[model samples]
Target: MKLGKSVNFTTILLLMFNMLLTSCGKNDDGSGPSPIPEPGDGVVYLPVVVHVVHNGEGLGEGPNLSEQQILRQIEILNEDYRRKLGTRGFNDHPDGGDAQIEFVLAKKTPDGEQTNGINRIDASQENVPDLGYNQNHYAQYAYWNPEAYINIWTTPLPESSMCLALGNATGPKTDLPGTEHLSIPGPNDADGIMINWIHFGESNIDCHARFGRTLTHEMGHFLGLLHTWGSGDCETNDYCDDTPPVDEHVYGNVPFVGCAGEEVMIGNYMNYSHDEVMNIFTNDQIQRMHYVLKHHPGRNALLTSPAL
Candidate 1:
C-alpha cells in the first residue's frame, strides 16, 4: 500500500484544515462502531420510497422524471451493490467486495395501502420554486415513517438559473469506529436521501452526474462510510484498511501517493472521483454499512419493516 512519492508536511496541513468543515460524525454524540459481524451469506433488502418535487412539470419532462428513469436508477444501485459482472459495478481489484444488499421500491404504504413508492409533488403550485436554501422543506410536504421506508426526495435545488447542487444523506445516530459522523445528529424522520431533480435517476441532466453515482456515493454516507481520505487528511482513517488514506480527493487518477505513503484508493465509491471511474466498495466498507444496519439508530427497524 506504500505510495511512490514523498510527502510535503506544510501542504498536508492545509489539506487537513480545509476538510474540517466537511467532517461528519461517527456518532451523533461520539461513539465507536460496534464490532463488525461476520460477513453473512444472505442478502439484505431495504424498502425505498421516492418523493419527486418538481416545478409544476408534467411527468417525464424537466424535474418530473419518467417512471423508467427512476427504475433505471434502482437497477444501477443494484449493479453496484451486488458487483454484477458485465456492468460498471464489477471490478477485479483485490480489495473489492459485494455489499450483498439491495433496494426495492416499497410495496405497501405505512397505512397498509398498495403503492409504487413514488410520490410526485408539484412545487410551483405551492409557490415554492425550489428546496434550495429551505432545507427540510420537503419533509413538510411528504414524509414516510423512517422505520418502515427510506425516503428519497428530489427537487430543484437551484434558486435562479445556475444549478450545481448534488445530493446528501443522513448517517446513523450511533457512530461507527473511527467515524466523525454527521454534524447534525438524529436519524430523524426526515432521514434518507435528498437529491437534485436534474441529476437524479437517469443522469440525463446537463451536469456532472452523467451516471447515478451521486446516489451510490451518498448512500455510502447514509450507511456510515466516510470519504476515502477521512476529513481530508493523510493520517486520517476511513476505518476501511483497503481504502488507503490520502490528503485530498482524487478524481480519476489511480495509485495516488497518500498522506501515509499508501496508494490511495481512487476508485472507491466513497471518494469524490469522476462518475465513470468510481465503482467498487472495499470489503471493510461493506462491513461498516452492514454494521450500521444492525446497530445504528432506526436502521435495525428497516430489517423488520413490512413495507416490502
Candidate 2:
C-alpha cells in the first residue's frame, strides 16, 4: 500500500520530532577511535526485514498505528544503526567510547535482486487472538535466506498484551539465558526478533518519557547488546566498560544518584529513558557486537563471501 505525499511528510516530521526527543547532543566524554575489529575478509551487512501485522481488525480496532509509522520506525533503525548522532541527554562517549561496526541496508539479495532489505506483512484473524498468526507465517517472508537477513515484527495491542509481548520495556530475560532458548518466547528466537507496539514502535514508553529509544535498545538486543547495567545482578555485566555499572533496568524517571556512582549515560540509546539523552555505543559494546556477528548463524557467509 502506498501512502499519499502528505501522509509521508507527516510521518517524517513525527519521526524527526521523536528522534529529537530521544537523541542526545554529542559529547566527547568517551571520545576515542572505533574499536570494532576488522572483519576477516568480506564486508558483512545485516539485512533486516520489518513485518507489520495489521491484526486485520483495521485501524482503531486494535492499535491504531499506520504503515507510515512502521516505515518511520525502519528509517529510524537504519539511521541509528549507521551513525551515532548524540543529543542533549545521550552521549556516544559516556567514558569516551568509540565503535567501528557499521550496517548498510542490503542493496542486493542472495539472488541479486534490488532490495532495501525490508518486508511488510498484513495478517488476518486466521489464527487465534493472542496467538495471532504463527511466527512461521511471517517468518517465511523474511526467510529469503537467513544467512543474509535479520527479521523484526511489530504489532499493537492492549496494555496487558504489551506486557506479555516478550521484550517489552523490561529488556531481554537474562537470568534464564537458556530460557530464551527453551520456550523461545514468542516463537523461534533463532529465526527473528519480535517487538510490540507499546515497546516496538518509534514511540517511547510513556512511563519512561522516552521517545523512540526502545527500538535502539531492542535492536541492541538483536545485534547482541546486553543491558548496560548488566544481567540481573550488579556484578554480572553486559561486558561494556564505558557504561557505568548499575543494579537494574532504568524505566520512566531516571535516578539522580544511582548508577553505582558512575556518571550516568542516561541519553545513550541503550538507557531506559527516552529523553534526548544517551546516544552512543561504547567501544566495548561495539567489540562485543562485532564479536557476536562473527558467530550469528545468519552472518557467517556475509563475512566470508558475500553478494556485494
TM-score of each: 0.80, 0.62
Off by over 4 Å in 1: 1-39, 127-135, 158-163, 187-189, 204-206, 252-255
lDDT of candidate 2 over 235-259, digit per residue (tens): 6555666666666676543544445
lDDT of 1 by residue, 59-162 (tens): 99877889998898888898998999998889999889889988999999888999898888887776534434333667776789888898888866553332
lDDT over C-alpha atoms for residue 14 of model 2: 83
Please give the lDDT score for candidate 1: 0.75
Query: lDDT scores for all predictions?
Result: 0.75, 0.52
State the local distance difference test value for candidate 2.
Answer: 0.52
Clash numbers, per candidate: 13, 29
